[model samples]
Target: MFVLAAALAATLAACGGGGGGGGQGGEDVTVASDIAYPPFEFERDGEPVGFDIDLLNEVGKRAGFTPEYQNVTFDGIINGLRNNQYDVAISSMTITPDREKRIDFSEPYFNADQSLLAPGDAGIESVDDLGDATVGVQLGTTGEITAREFKDEGTINGEIRTFDTIEDAFNALENGQIDAIINDLAVSQYEAKNSDGNAEIIEVIPTDEQYGIALPKDSDLRQDINEALAEIKEDGTYEEIYKKWIGRAPEEIPR
Candidate 1:
C-alpha cells in the first residue's frame, strides 16, 4: 500500500498546472480525471465521454464557463486538487472524510458501492466466500480499501492485487490470474454483463458510497456547481443522463 501511494504521489506531482475559482484570474476551470474508469470516465473514440464527463460539462455550461479536463491517474486526483493543479474533479470520486479534509466536494452526483465479479462457476456467492481466493481491485480506490479491510479481518484469506485501472483488474480476473475483481457495483455489473460469459457479477457490497466532484479547499465554485447540479436534477437533465448511462433512474439521486 505504501508503494502504491508513493507511485500515485509521484504521478500527481507530474501533472502540474494552474488553478482558479470560476473564471477568476484568467485561469481555466480545469477538471482532472483518470479517464480509465468506464461508464463514469473513459475514452470513447479518443474523446472523454461518460456520465461524469457529460454531467460536469453541463455543470460548467450552466455555471457560465467551459471546463478543461486533464487526464490524471486515479490515485493522483485528490493530490492534484489539494495542490490546485486542477480547479475541480468529477472522476467518480467517492466522498470520504479523509478526502473531505484535503479538499471540498460538490454534493454527490452519484451513489455507488463495491461489487464482486467472478466466473459463473466460481461458487463465490458473496463477498464472504472469498476466504482463499485472490481478489483484484483498482489502486487507491474504496474497493482496494475494502479488500484490505476484509483481508485484515480474515474475511478474505488470499492476496489483494491492486491494478492501475479497472480494465486491467477485469482482465486479470478473466485471464484466471485473479479469482475475482472488486470495483464500483455499476461498472462491475457493466463489465461482467459485457464480458461475453467471461465473468458475472456475483454480489454487490452495500457500502452506500456517494461520488462527488472534487474542488480545492474553500473553492467558491462549490456553490456555483451545486446550483447547476440542482438545476439539472430539477429540470430533468439529470434523469436523462442517468437513464442513458445507467439504464434506469434510482429512487432518488440525493443532493
Candidate 2:
C-alpha cells in the first residue's frame, strides 16, 4: 500500500552497533556506509547505531542473510558498491535518477528534504536570501547538489565549501569559515540542536527526496530485501524502531 505523495515518518532504537569488517556468512552482505550521518547511521561508543543500522539488521534477519557494515566515504560509497567491495550500501542515500543508472535501489524507506543551517543571527530566513553568503555542505551529497543549484541559478552568489562529513560542515559554520550548511532536515536539525546555540535551521527546501538502500545492478538480493522491508512494515517492527529513534511513529512511510 505505497503512495506517491506519502508523508514520511520515523522511529528508532540502537541496533547493529559496530564498526569494521563483516564476518563470513553463508550469504555475506557487506553494507558500505559513511558512518557520520546521525539519526540514520553514525558511530556511538565506537560502534554504529541509528535508524538505518537498526532497520538493516532486521531486514537482513528476515531476508536470510548476514549484514556487515563497512565505513566508507559518502563520495566513494557508490564506486565501492560497483566494484564489489560491498554487497550493498545504506547511509541515508537518496534515490536519484542519475544514481539508478549504476545501481539498484530497494523501496524508498525515508522521505527527506533539504534544509539550511545558519547562525541564529544570520538573518537568512529562506534560500532566496542566501545571496553572497558562503554555504558549507558534505561532499557527494544532495546538500551539495542543492547548494550548487542555488549558485548556478544565482539564488546565492557565495562560496560553497565541501566537507567530508556533516560535523565538519557544522564546525565550519560555528567557526565562521562558512555562513551556512545545507543538509538534510533531520540531520541539520539534530546537529543544530546539539550545537549549543552555535547553529540553527533557517530554511527548509522541499525536494521530496526518498532514501533507499543501494545494491549492485542485477543483484539477486534486491527482491528479498524489498520483501523483508514490506514484512517489517506489515508486522509493525518498522513502527517500533521508528519510534525509538525518530521519537514518533511514521505517518506515511512509503509502502
Candidate 3:
C-alpha cells in the first residue's frame, strides 16, 4: 500500500492533478511542522490541527499521499526534510531566495508577513523602539529573520533569543523573559488571545512573503503540491479550511 502511494504521488507529480497514478499506495508522508504555530499549524485535542494541516490534508487527499505529521522546531523543519526525517514540510514556510537554495517550495498556499508582539504596557512598540531589549523569535521562521535584521541594524541591542517554538517565545514574553516576540501576524494574535490577553500586537512587519510547502531541492513533491494546491483552492476547499482555523476568509493583506 505504501509503495502504491509513492508511485501515485510520483505520477500525480508529473501529470498535474488530472487523475490517479498507477497505484493507490498508502505510503505515509511525514509532514514536519511546528505544532506551536496556532491557526497555521498547532496541537489541538492532542492532535495536529491548523490551517496548514487542513490545507495539506486536502492536498494529500487530492494528490494521493497519506500525511503523518512530525512535530519539530519550526527552524528545523527544512533540515528535517533534507535529512529524511520527513518527506515534506507544511509549516507556514515562506519561499525565499535563501531558502530556495536549501529546498524547493510549492506555489504559495498563503501569504503573510512577520509581526511584532509585546506586553501592552511596556512602552516598547514597533521594531525601531526595540533597542537594547531582549527580542524573542520563533527559530526557523521568517520572524526569526526579521528579528535578526533588527539586531544586525542595532535597532535592537539586547539578546535575540531564538526559542524552539512560538509558544515558548510567547511564554517568555509573558514571564518577562523577553520584551517582545516576532511571529506571523495571525498566529501571533491567536497565541495572544489564547493566553487571555497577556500579549498584544505591537506591529506587523512589512514583509512581503508567500507561504509555501518545503520539500527537498529538486524533489518532485514540490511540483505535485503546487498542482494539487491550485485545484484545492479553486474547489472551495481552501476557503473552508481557512474559515475553520482562522475564523474568517483571508483578505488581501498588504504587507
Candidate 4:
C-alpha cells in the first residue's frame, strides 16, 4: 500500500483556488471536469456523477474541504486549470508531455487504455477489419492517436471522422457513418453496458497511458495532490472505487 506522506495542511492547500463562499467554516474549492465522459465524470439525472466524482468527494471529505463542480468540456479542462478557472480538473485527464508542460498532474489515479468498438453486424471483429475502412475518433484524444497510427500503416482507409466529443463519435458509429470508434476502455464499457446491447467493446487497445488529476504548474498543490493520490491507492479507496464502477480493479501501474 502506498502511503501519502505530505502534511495534511499542504494537501488542503492545493485546493486553494476559485470562489471561497461555502460558508466560512470550510475552505471553498471548485473542480473542473468534462461531464460528457461517463463512468469517469458525467451528468446523471441533472447532476454530475461517476467514479472520479466519488473519489474526489471522498478525498475532499478526508482532507477537510468542500468542492463545487463545474461542467466544462474536455478540451477546456487543461486550459481551465492553467487559467485558474477552477481549483483542479478531474476529467479523467491523461497525463502527457504536451499537458505536463502547461500544468502539473497528481499521481495517476486510474490506468486505462483506449478501446475500439464496432457494430456486431459490420463484421468488424478485430483491428484487421478496420483495414482500409473509415474509422472514427474524438478530436484531440488518444482515439485520434490510434486512428492516425492505423492510417499511417495503411490499415485504415477512407477519411477519419473526427467528432468534438466521444458521445458524438459513438453516435456516428451507431448511425453507420463510420466503421468503429476508439476511446478509453472504461468509457467504452460504460457505453456498452448502457447501450441495451446495441454496442460492444470489440477490442481493447494495448497502451500504457493513465488518467490523472490536472492542476496548474509551479503550484504547491502538485506535491499535495500527489500525496493525496498516493494515500488513496495505499488505502483501499482506489480499488473500492474501481470495483464500484468497472467491476474490477486494474493493475495500478499498468503493465
Candidate 5:
C-alpha cells in the first residue's frame, strides 16, 4: 500500500507541472502534511483542520492559490518536497540548518520546544530521571534527534524507540509499552490535557526552535507565501489563529 502511494505521488509530481505554475492566479497548490499532529495539522470529519491548515488557507487566499492538501507521514515530508512530490509543507516543521540544506522555508511562524511526557505516576520529573527507561519519539522529528543526543551523551541510558506518529508514541506510553515520550511541547501538552489523568508533561526541554512553512528549494512561491504570511501576522489574523488553536494568545510571535 505504501509503495503504491509513493508511486502515485511520484506520478502526480511528474504530471502536475510542479503543482501550481509558481503561484499564478488561483492555481491549486499541492500541500504535503503529516495530518495527525493536532493543533498544528490533523484530520477532523474526514478533512484536515488545524492551525497550519487555517493559516495556510488564509495564506493561499492572499497568495492567489488554492492549497490541495495531501496527507502523509511526517518522516516522508522532507523527502517528498525534495522530490517535488508537493509544492509546500506546513507540518509544524522546525527550521534547522541541516534541513535548510535540502529545502527552503518561509520565515519562522511558531516558536516551539521539546517536552517529556509520561504517565502521571511514573515518578519521572525530568530527562535526568529516565536513567534506563524506554523513551519513545516520533520518527525523524527533532524529538527523536534530542533523544538520540541524550543517549549519546549518557543522559538517557535506555532504549530509544521511534514511532511513525506522535499519537503512536502516546499510545505506547499509555499502554506502558514505553516509559515516556519526547516530542513537541505543545503537542505533548495537548495529549496530556486530553489524557484524563493518564498522562502529564514531566519536563519541558528547551530547544528554542521555530516552525516555518517549507517549500521546495528555490521555489518561486516562497516570496508569495512569505508576503502573505507577513500580511496575516500584521492584520491580526495570525494572532486569532494562534488563540483559536493554541488556546491562548501567543506571548510572542516568531519572526
Candidate 6:
C-alpha cells in the first residue's frame, strides 16, 4: 500500500497536480517581450531590465508565479500568444480593440502617445512637414498604424519605411537613412535625451493609448495578474517603478 501511494503521488506531481490554481500554479510562467524597447523592456548585461520588467516582476510576486522572460520581436508577440507559445507578454503593448479580440489584457498600466522624431536641423517640426520624406516606424506598432493613418488622410506624401525594431528605426534616423521617425512619445523622449542632440522630438501626437499586460485569450492568470496590478498601483509601487525607468513620477496612473 505504501509503495502504491508513493507511486500515485509521483504521478500526480509529474502531471502538474497538487497545486490549487489553474495553469502554472505557482510555477515558472513564460513571459514574451520585445527586449529592445527601452524605458519599457530592454537588456542590460544579458538580463531584461526596464519599466515593464520591474512592474511584471512585482505582479508575479503577488500573483504566486515567477516569470521566465523570452526575448522576441514586437510583431510576433500577439501571434505567439494566440498560438500558446507564450504565457504572457508585457512589452509596452498598448491595449487596442483589434488586439483585445485575439488576446486578453490586464488592467491599464501605462499611458502612451506617438511622437515625431527628426534631426535637430531637419526642419521637420510636425507631421505636416513630412511630405515627400522617408518616415521610419517599427512594424506592427501603434506608431506604424498612426503613420499609415496620416498617409491615408494625405497628411504626408512619404515613404513609410518599416523596421523590425524601434532601435533600428532610431539608427536609421541617426544615420540620415530616414528623414523622420514616428514612435511612442516617452520612448522617443528617452532616445532624444540620449542622442547628444542628434535627434529631437518635433511633435507630440496624442493617440490616447494605454498599455496593458497581455496574455493568451481567456487565460486563467488574468484575474490573478489584475488583482496584483491593482494592489501595486494602490500601494505606490507602480509610481516608484514608473519614476525609476521613466525619470519622473507619473502624473496619473492608468486605469
Question: Residue-pair clashes per candidate, as listed?
Answer: 0, 7, 6, 1, 0, 0
**TM, every model:** 0.88, 0.88, 0.85, 0.84, 0.91, 0.90
Give the alpha-carbon lDDT of every model. Answer: 0.86, 0.86, 0.80, 0.77, 0.93, 0.92
Q: Write the per-residue lDDT of candidate 3 for residues 1-255, one digit (tens) a residue.
A: 999999999987866433333243455677788877888887778988888888888788778787877788777777777787778998888899998888788888787877889988899768888878888887777888888887787788888898887788888888998998888888888877777777888898878789888888777677777788988888778878877888888784212
lDDT by residue (tens digit), candidate 1, 1-255: 999999998877765543334342333578899888878889989889989988988888788766777888889888888998888998888999988999999998888988888998988899898988999999999999988988898889998998988888888888899999888998887797789988998888889999998999999899999999999988999999898888888668767
Q: Please, what are the lDDT tens digits per residue for candidate 6 over residues 100-156?
A: 999999999999999999998988888898899999999999999999999999999
Write out the backbone clash pairs for model 1: none
Candidate 3 residue-wise lDDT at 237: 81
Write the residue-wise lDDT of candidate 4 on 90-110 in tens digits.
Answer: 888788888899998877788
- Model 3 per-residue lDDT at 108: 82
Error of 4 at 114 (Å): 1.5
Candidate 2 positional error at 156, Å: 0.6
Error of model 5, residue 210, in angstroms: 0.3
**Model 6 pairs in collision:** none
The weakest ten consecutive residues by lDDT in model 4 span: 16-25
* lDDT value, residue 187 of candidate 2: 90
| lDDT per residue (tens digit) for residues 112-215 in model 5 | 99999999798898999999999999999999999999999999999999999888888888899999999999999999999998999999999999999999
- Show where candidate 2 strays beyond 4 Å: 1-26
Model 6 weakest lDDT span, ten residues long: 16-25
Q: Once superposed on the true structure, which residue ranges of model 1 sit more than 4 Å away at CA? A: 1-27
Off by over 4 Å in 3: 1-25, 253-255
